[model samples]
Each structure stands twice: as C-alpha cells, then as structure tokens.
Target: MINSTIKHLTFITLIIIGFSISFTSCYYDVEQELYPKPIDNGISCDTSTATFSVKIYPLIQSKCNSCHSTAISSGGVSLEGYNNVLSAQQNGSLMGTINHSNGYNAMPQGAGKLSDCEIANLNTWIHAGALNN
Candidate 1:
C-alpha cells in the first residue's frame, strides 16, 4: 500500500511539473517586439516641399495632437485646426517649446525632444511662410 501511494504521488508530481514548465515557456515578453527601436535609413530627411497637409499636419498629429487636440487641449492650447497651429507658430511657442529653448516649456511634456531632422523640417516649413497649403 505504501509503495503504491509513493508511485502515484510521484506520477502526479511529474505531471504538475510538466504542465508548469510548458505554461511558463509558452509565454515570454519580447522587449524588442514590444518596443521597437527607431530605424535610421542613412538617408537625409527631406523637407523641401513641407506642405501642411503632407508634412506639417501629420507631424503635429502624431506628436502634439495627443496633448493639444481640440478634445483635450492641455494647458489651454489647441493645435486641432490650422488656425490654432498657426497661432502657436506665429507666437514662436511652437519652435520654442519643441527646441527646448530657455524660458519656454519643453513640449510633448514627458517625451524626448524632437529629432534634429524633425526640428529642421518644422523650421523649414515655418520659414516658407507657414502657408495653409
């Protein structure tokens, strides 16, 4: 009787160990897949024709829209429409904040500063008269 019970318990223990190993091995966190590193294609960024619809709007939408959109408008600033974006640009806050210049609030709140290429693109667009187009 004692030998039978020992054998049964050993079998059950082995089954539980097998199940635990399978379950743990099947699930794993992939750091790279979860948070991918930004890729650099070794090509220079192009901002020659930085139109609002094509370049400026999309950039702002991805980066600034979360905090400055019409629905939320954090800090009483709205970058939803072209007019609102224009206001920020005209007043120099857009450049100041993004550039992390002195006496201006660093933008995107907690995120890293925009890349040099991105900043250059914005500067190019603004210098090109910041047209609605």
Candidate 2:
C-alpha cells in the first residue's frame, strides 16, 4: 500500500513538472511573437538621378512633410529637403520607420495612409537612385 501511494505521488509530481515546463515555454513563445526582431530587406533600387521637383518633392510635401518637416518636427524628425531625406536613409531611420509595423509610429498621424501608387513612385525613385534634381 505504501509503495502504491509513493508511485501515485511520483506520477502526479511528474505530471505537474511537465505542465509547468510547457506552460513556461508557451509564455516565452508568446512574448517572442509579440516582439519580433527587425529585418532588413535591403534597398529596392540602384543609383540613378530621379526628377525631384515633379516626382519626389511633391509626394514628400503632400504626404509626409506636413508633420515630418522642419516646422512641426514630429518625432524629432524632418523631411523638408532632399538632403534631409537622404540623411534619413543613411541613418537607417527612413526604412526602419516605414517598414516597421509597431516599433515606430507611422507618419502622417491621424491621416489616411499613402496610396499604393505614391509608395511605388517613392520606391522607384529610391531604387533608381535618390536624386537631387
């Protein structure tokens, strides 16, 4: 009778231990999923002079610079000039912020998101080579 009781107690203890380990592992996995690591897909373009006045500048002014420009300076960032945009790219903040889904807040707060066509234009400009003109 004593041996049987000991065996039952051992079985219960083993079950509890297993449950605890699995529960701890699941908790860790949930945390990892909640906060994923950053990924760099790389710039999608090469060096080429793009038309800034017609193609690039307008997009920035309309879609981004309202809050991101020197005047308001949201997030301690600016996108007023070509040099500023280029500097953002060099510092990794541009791509980092745009690609992020959560780490940093999206630009143009409280406004509609940029259209796909506009995003494509910007991507094309960057891929062709960020231009000054």
Candidate 3:
C-alpha cells in the first residue's frame, strides 16, 4: 500500500511537471514579431531634383488641380499652368495654404494634407526661384 501510494504520487507529480513544461514552453513573448519595426524600402526623399514640370506641377495637378484648375478655380485660385503656379507661389498663397499657415486656408480641401516629401519638393522648387522648368 505504501509503495502503491508512492508510485501514484510520483506519476501525478510527473504529469504536473509535464503540463507545466508544455504550457510555459508554448508561452512566447516574441518582441520582434509582436512589435515589428517599420521596414525601410531604402527609398530616400530627394528634393535636389525638384523641378516645376517634373515635381511641382505634377504634384499640383494631382492634388490641387482638381479644384483649383482654370475651369474650376475654387477660392479664386488657379493652378493649371506654370504661370499661374508661379503667380501663386510669388503671392505667398500657395505655400501658405499648403503649409496650413495661420490666416491661410488649408489646401487640398476635403482631403488629407500632402506628404512631407511632396511638401519638401515644393519648398525646394520655390527656393530655386520657382521657375517654369
């Protein structure tokens, strides 16, 4: 009877130990998988090649031309052509509105703001004299 009780207790203790090992082994706190860092696609923001036709005008066409084109001219703003764009940049309204500065309306109305790269490209173009090119 004493030997049988000892064997039973030993079996139960072994089962509990196995269960504890299985549960703890399966439990994982993988920090890398749980909280993944953002992947870098190796793409860098290059504003050095910023140009009116290549960078600025296309961006404006896609973002601003919807409402500020020659046909629509919402809020008395026209961003259709290079001349009109230069005019706006010169008048301080383009950057003011896009930068969402005080006393100026935020542009791309009813939509999200432009990306930092896009804004930086515009700034680079403007600082480069906002030429037709």
- Candidate 3 residue 131 Cα shift, in angstroms, is 0.8
lDDT of 1: 0.87
Which portions of model 3 miss their true places by more than 4 Å?
A: 1-43
lDDT of model 1, residue 32 = 66
Cα lDDT tens digits for candidate 2, 3-41: 999999999999999999999888745554555432222
**Alpha-carbon error at 52 in model 1, in Å?**
0.9
Off by over 4 Å in 2: 1-50, 99-102
TM-score of model 1 relative to the true fold? 0.66
Whose lDDT is higher: candidate 1's or candidate 2's? 1
Clash list (residue pairs), candidate 1: none
Please provide TM-scores, in order, for all candidate models, with all chains considered together.
0.66, 0.54, 0.67
Name the lDDT value of residue 65 in candidate 2. Answer: 88
Off by over 4 Å in 1: 1-43
Q: Evaluate all candidate structures by whole-model CA lDDT and list the values in order.
A: 0.87, 0.69, 0.86
In Å, residue 13's CA in model 1 sits off its true spot by 66
Which consecutive 10 residues in model 3 have the weakest lDDT in total? 35-44
